[model samples]
Every structure is written in C-alpha cells, then in structure tokens.
Target: MVALSFISLVGCEASVATHPVSGKVVLADGSPVGGGIIKFRTKSDEGETVKAHGQIQPDGSFQLTTFQDGDGALEGEHEAILFSPATGDGHNAVAAPNFPTKYRKYETSGLKFQVGPGENDFVIQLGTR
Candidate 1:
C-alpha cells in the first residue's frame, strides 16, 4: 500500500487552489460584446505565472476556468485581455477589429484586476481608445 499512498500524495500536490471568477464584457455604450474570449494571467510572487480563460457568451457574460471547467483562477493580480473575432460577412470576408488593438495583448491591454480568496465578479469596459 506504500505505492498507493505515494500516488495519492502526488495527486494532491499537483492540484492548485483557485477561486471563482466571473464577469461581463461590455463596450463604452454598455453593449455586450457578443462572442469572444477573456484571459486572465497573473504574475506570482514566486516567479510563476498562472492563466485562466473564459469564453464570452451572447450576453457578454463569462465564467473563468483554470485547470477545470468553471474552477476559476489563482488568487493574485491579473492582467485581462479581451479578444473578439470579427463578425460580419461570411466565408471569403474580411474580419473587422472589435476592441482596440492594444487591448488584445496582455502587456499592452492596461486592464488589471485582483482575484481574491473568494468570488471575483468584474465588469470589463472597452473603450474606443
């Protein structure tokens, strides 16, 4: 049974603690983004970074998941990046940009949030600039 005990310990050690994270993505006019992705990346004090991702729904609502579905993200400071695929024409159609190009990259998005030990509900606002 020694091997079984060791396996259990390994499994426990591989799990990371996470908290629930949910939010809405809206424009300056308070309109929903429709469809897209939202990513939350954190720079940890231990020099390791963790990332969580959520898909924006039709109503612009989203629930973040890190290791599992709706499991949320690690508690820390995070940089949020919003990506909305162009929607318009059909096949052979050019895709238009939704938010500003700067918001697509985590380094330049300028959107920051703090995930606490409990539930985190945020409202992300996108601007023209």
Candidate 2:
C-alpha cells in the first residue's frame, strides 16, 4: 500500500489549518454597505507582510481568506481597508472612490484588528466624510 500511503501524505501536506475570521461592515448611520471589498495586511514575526482579502456581501458581511477560500488570515495585528467602485459620469473616464478616500488606504483608514489563535468576529464601523 505504498501508493496509498503516499497519497495520504500528499493530501495532509496540502491542507493547512487556519483560524476563522469573519466580520460585518457598516456605516456611521448603521446601514450595511451594499457592495465592496475588504482587505487585511499584516507583517508576520518574520517581517514578511501577508495580505488577505474578502468580498463584501450585499448584507455587509465578509470572511477573510488568505491562501484558500475561507481559510482565514495569518494570526497577528492587521490594518484593514474598505473599497467600493466609484461611479463616473460618461464624460469623465476616471472612476473615483465610492467610499471616503481615506478609507481606501490601509495605513490611513485607522481600521485595525487583532487576530488571536482562535476564531475572530468583528464589526467594522465606517465614518462619513
């Protein structure tokens, strides 16, 4: 059963355990954002920065995933940024930021979250411009 043993080993090596992280995005008025994207970036103890991203649902819920779907993010502190596609007039070609421009950059957003060894659930509140 050498082949069987090898197959099992391969499968185990391919799967990495991850902590679960989920959150909700809401505005200052406490209304859910219809659509957007959320991202988390953190520097590991090794000094390498890792990023995880998730799509904001219509109900403003999101789950962070790094390597695989729903696999979750690396454990540590993270800076978060939220973004939604800005609408542009037919005459203007450039699309502006839908949310506050300050929120588009992780460093400027003033949004931070710490991920522990276990599951993390967070509620992110956004301020109006």
Best by lDDT: 1
* Candidate 2 structure quality by residue, lDDT tens digits, 1-129: 999999996685356345789988888898877577889988766687778898888888999998778878888888999887554577875433277888889879999999878889999887764
Model 2: worst 10 consecutive residues (lDDT sum): 9-18
Name the runs in model 2 displaced over 4 angstroms. 1-17, 85-97
What are the TM-scores, per candidate, against the unseen true structure?
0.77, 0.75
lDDT of 1 by residue, 1-129 (tens): 999999886685357678999999888889877677889999655677778999888888999998779999888889989887656568665443366778899989999998999889999888743
Q: Tell me the deviation in Å of residue 70 in model 1.
A: 0.3
Assess the local accuracy of residue 129 in candidate 2 as a C-alpha lDDT between 0 and 100: 42
* Model 1 TM-score, all chains together: 0.77
Judged by whole-model lDDT over C-alpha atoms, candidate 2 comes out at: 0.81
Assess the local accuracy of residue 106 in candidate 1 as a C-alpha lDDT between 0 and 100.
92
